[model samples]
Target: MTPADPARRRLLLAGACLAAWPLAASAARAPQRVRDSRALMGTRLDVAAQGPDAEALQRAIDAAFARMTALSALMSHYAPASQVSAIGLAAGLQPVEVAPELMQVLHMARDVARRTDGAFDPTVGALGLWHFDAPQSSIPTASEIRRRISSVDWRHLVLDERRQTAYLTERGMRLDLGGIAKLSILQSGLDTLQAHGVGTALVNGGGDVVACSQRGDAPWRVGIRDPRAPQRLLATLEVRSGFVASSGDYERFFVQDGRRWHHVLDPRTGRPTEGVRGITLVADSLEAVNGLGTAGMVLGARAGRELLRRGEGVEALIASADGGLWMTDRLRARLVPVAG
Candidate 1:
């Protein structure tokens, strides 16, 4: 299929959501497969096996979805009643005991923040003042941005590994997992499927996709959407086992006064990233892809590539704000450019 084909994009989305679920009318089908109910994470999850394994596949999919829902409830900062929100409310006053999953994600968040030199900070919760998704959007004043920037310090997050307690060193500090949590959950789902005797699986959460297992007759193909032309494809990657995560300025943004304000906040400035239209990362692990995607968006183009290069098992493709495209040697080798 052509990468830019609308049907291809839709199919990709369907495959990502349903993972192993067989398409209703597709000519291909495995011996045993069943589609499961959608999960609270808003992604479709299904399983397909080659033998008389319907019951086993169903159980595996159900267990994976349940774990994902529980993790979402615990780590969601938007849900004021979640553990993350509770910790934000109690910031600086007392330590809050977090779930093991939450602690693990937080630790990874902190490490990425340090590696990116605070570019991919979890403390971007301070920028809660702006909502680009709103109908009427306004840019925060310089003074307001400065005030919020002061609260964006990843070091303030103190974790007691033994007790699984996390304390925010300052009041008003919060953790926004919108950056990586969903992809992390997808990775975990893939791992679960692998353990269930499912030799191959694909997990696609919106723009992020993770695929594993021996290749079929043809290598698995992933399309890279064009930010300037959503209906068109920019490139495709032939991947067998790894993760692909993308962050795009086009997905969530508001145009005001001839400028676009997107959801990707620069912790140092408390403003949307500029000069970067989108970033996509290919990595062996979800942690690397998710972390680097965020860092790449914040670092823009040049520095973002450097950041990805420093991390092992990671490669990146960057789309500049001006519509120029660049990829590291590692990524270029796997990329199949699509005609505009």
Candidate 2:
């Protein structure tokens, strides 16, 4: 055939476009990696995963978030109808049966309380009457604090493992798992992702996070946000696996008389813990250092160092209000400070 005409050339191009349409659509729909986030347990929970297809990744994300929702229902103090609230209502009166997961978290809370010498008491719930976010400014009276402090004893938390029951020996006592429960829930979400055959995933429960596998060939990188400047990062880490928990005094608090009255309460004083501004701990599991950060804020640098030394693979970076940083050598090695 001699040289084709312009009309013949246009018809040939149209045929080629129609033939490639299906393949272009297929490539567009192919899934590589995805991230999902939702607010649950009174905090933002996030999941990142890589999958062969979008549907599989969505299913895994749903499962992970569902696990968090269930745990929150069982443990959240904000939920008046929750099992935790029920236990509070029945305090000192009867032993309330609870789910195995709740029992496990409570046990872990007790362990932290003992290890911290009551510095990590979940019984600080007795001090919940104080509201930092109230429209009208108010502080708890010393007499009222003293009376509430009487019921703020972790020793009074009686658990019957045989019956899977929890009891508070004081009528007005309450349990607040605000410190440790988040980490436990994060671990549970990671476990759910694993069960769903997702090998590469990260479950971030607010400031606490856990990674299952590398981000592609490289390790997952996470930023530790600056406590003083919420928008800036103090440091970043290249984490291959395991947990990172960051606790800060600025997380929930109100300014009063030029002082930050935060939510990290000390059961002993029935008031917010002072001294340390923030603490970030890296460990193999939440079981290793779940509530240590909160207790570290109360104990200050000297005792915080001693407490961290007791753990085998735990590393920490603690910041004080004096603009000084106290960090374990191991954490220093892995942490990259953000350059100003």
Please tell me which predicted candidate would have the highest TM-score against the true structure.
2
For residue 302, give model 1's deviation from the true position in Å.
Answer: 1.5
Model 1: per-residue Cα lDDT over 118-224, one tens digit each: 88888888778887656756688888888877888999989999888998899878888788787887777777777776655566665777776543423347777
For model 1 the local lDDT of residue 332 reads 82
Cα lDDT tens digits for candidate 2, 147-168:
8999999999989999999999
Clashing pairs in 1: 17-44
Compute the lDDT for candidate 2.
0.77
For each candidate, what TM-score against the reference? 0.85, 0.88
Off by over 4 Å in 2: 1-31, 134-138, 214-216
